[model samples]
Target chain A: MSMTMTAIVLGMTVVTYIPRMLPFVLLKGKELPSFWQSILQNVPYATLGALIFPSILTFHEDPSFALIGAAAAFLIAFTGANIIITVLGSIGILTVLSLFL
Target chain B: METTAAAQSEFKDGLAAGTGIAIGYVPAAITYGLLAKSAGLTFIETMSLSIFVFAGAAQYIALSLITIGTGIFEIVLTTFILNIRHFLMSAALSEKTEEEPIWKKAAYSFGVTDETFSVAAMKSGSIHSSFMAGLILISYSSWVLGSGLGYVAGNAMPPVVQESMGIALYAMFIGLLVPSLKTSLKAVLLAATAAILNCIFTYSGALSSGWAIIISTLIASISVEMAGRAREKGGIE
Candidate 1:
């Protein structure tokens, strides 16, 4: 890599590393308050919801196909089908739908 | 000798898993590479970003922001906001790593991607440094390899193929969500509320699709907690 690219890469690495490392350093060997801990427990659900919901619903120009695809994938996944199968099912459905619409 | 052996076994396990994750991530990372290249990044620049930035969504957002000539400060600020969840993930994993030395703990923490967190949390028995390290190494290597492939394969793919690859992310998300849906009503409610709020935000033009995720997730999570507390007091499920 060029010097400029190398420098940028290193800079980004440090910045990214700081965030990941901070909590481990600061929160280790400490007892968070119970209420805060409870709140923390919910963080994953919240973060995942935030990350997935918007993109699945309205981010696309026509979200219906994606929603249908998601619903199909969800149902299949819920039925204990493998993830690859579920995704393929959704993509298959979308491809078929595109043919019709 | 047994301890050393176990550690060796654990590191091998990590390397194996990292190899698997790298394989899974290749397609998506390739897509990112193509997008980055098409967005005017040189191959070196694109690969460097992947190696350093490492956060998938944030890297994509940064590329888009850069392409549109968003100010450096704004791009940095957005990257920071998007990555706020890493703080929570790191904290959760930190509690689970009580036995490791500080340096090992720090090294392992750097590899805490979303998939790694779920895998690590679900791991049985007391946390072993080697096992956790293996898990992280697997995930980190997968991410880097995927990014590299994406860079190399840039723009050679058909548009249809590119669009289809996005299904992988949605597929992965659904995989995560489906299991959780059965675990709790709070999970369902949280997901539904976020979906609704996301639609509202998108329609209102209040936030970009990415930022809407951060907003809706925060609101839905807080609401789920408050509602859960109220229900528990009232003996509601």
Candidate 2:
């Protein structure tokens, strides 16, 4: 890899690490408010939704393809399909759509 | 007296969880090692990134941006923004695990990942240090191993194939959303809201894709919280 690429990658490693590590360090043994506790409980769902939502809608040539695949994956998962199947099914459907479109 | 025993137990549980996560990580890390090498990253560079960044999505984003000749400043800014969710995750986990020593907390924090957070949160009882440590260790090992493997396998695959591998993270995210949807209507609403907001933002051209996520999340989360509160007040199920 180029020197610049290497540096960028390394730099990113540092930035990402700090954020992940800070709370464990700073908040250790510190009591947090109940409101903060409630908020924390809800944050993961919100954050994950935020992270995954855009991709499901926008990752394909026809946004509908992604939407359909996501819906299928969601249904399958909701119905208790194994995780591997859910992901593979979505990918398979998208790939097929890609081939056709 | 009981508290100390509980603390010890929590630490042990954390270690066990970390080990379990690490077992799965071995293959994935190998894949990552191959990817990095093909992307023109050297062994040491890839290792450093795996050791430090440890975030799959952000690292992949950084890699893509670098390959496309995005400026360093832009890349860094985008990554920082994309990873803002960690603040929320960490803050949440911290609340649950406020009994550990500072150094131990810091070490465990370093190992936080999406999988670790999920595993830890899903545990049935009060959060303990060992369980948290177990979860983190498993995830941390998987990540390091995956990156190492990706670097080694990097040269063997075509760029197209490597790019396709990028979907694994998205696939995992989908897996996460699906299971949760079965248990809670709130989760479904939050997810659907996020999707709608994401589509709106993408189409509006008002916000960049990265920022769009942050914006949509905030809006959707607030809406869900409000709607939930209203339901509770009305004595509705």
Candidate 3:
């Protein structure tokens, strides 16, 4: 590869992998304090939540259809459908809605 | 007798669980590939980004930076900031899985994306490395393969169709978040807080998008957790 491409790839790899690898190296077999653990436990839900919400409203140019997509996802997910089904169902609803609305 | 069999079966169960993630990843990764192609990345460039970086949002940002002729230092810095959340994910996961050699831990940690982390976190009890490997294996491969496929398929698609596919990304996030929301009121409040905080940060132009996400996640979760603890102490619902 060209030097620039190689540099970009290596840089990307390092930055991406470090966050993933650091905690494993530092905290292996160790239990965090309960307060910290409680914070850690809520990380996923909070992060995923931050990614969605108002952001979903702006993801599509048509905010109305995006709402339909979000609602579809919420309905399927509320039913406790598997992740694949919930996502696919939402996309399917939006694709159909995109056609009509 | 049951121990070996259970371990073996758990690996299969992990693979089964990962199928949903794999399916979700394909469309998003495909969109990434298509976008990368439009941004002037060759097939190898797009594929290598997916293979090496392996983070969807980071790669998309990379494409944007590349298009703008951003310097390597800035691009790398942005991705680092964006992916810093993985540290929290890995830290949380460290508590749930059995101890293994740091090398194996390193290997599995590489696959810890937002989606896979949620899958692993939602599983009951201590997670087996074998199960993690199985889950990571399928989800990782689907991402790689989907990127390649999307790069190959980039040319034939119409512009409008490509634009519509963007919604699939948000839909996937909703799918991941909504299930958790159903189980707890705290989760719902946590999500709303994070979302509102993120929106304010971005709208106010007070912080970069990466910083916004990291700060919102930290503040919303830690505060909500403390509030929950306070409520419990006071014997309030």
The TM-scores of all predictions, comma-separated, are: 0.79, 0.72, 0.90
Candidate 3 C-alpha lDDT tens digits along A29-91: 677899998888888778887777557788677788778778887888888887778767776
lDDT of 1 by residue, A8-67 (tens): 456556666777788888887889887667666665666556556666664346777667
Q: Which stretches of candidate 3 lie over 4 Å from their true place?
A: B1-4, B155-169
Residue B184 in model 2: lDDT: 90
**Cα lDDT for residue A76, model 2?**
64
Ranking by lDDT: 3, 1, 2
Q: Is the docking of candidate 1 incorrect, acceptable, medium or high quality?
A: acceptable
Better TM-score candidate (2, 3): 3
- What's model 3's lDDT at B214? 80
Q: What ordering of candidates by TM-score runs from best to worst?
A: 3, 1, 2
Which is better, 1 or 3, measured by DockQ? Answer: 3
List lDDT for all candidates, in order: 0.68, 0.66, 0.82
Residue A86 lDDT, candidate 3, scale 0-100: 79
> Distance (Å) between predicted and true CA of B90, model 2?
0.8
**What is the lDDT, from 0 to 100, of the residue B231 in candidate 3?**
88
Ranking by DockQ: 3, 1, 2
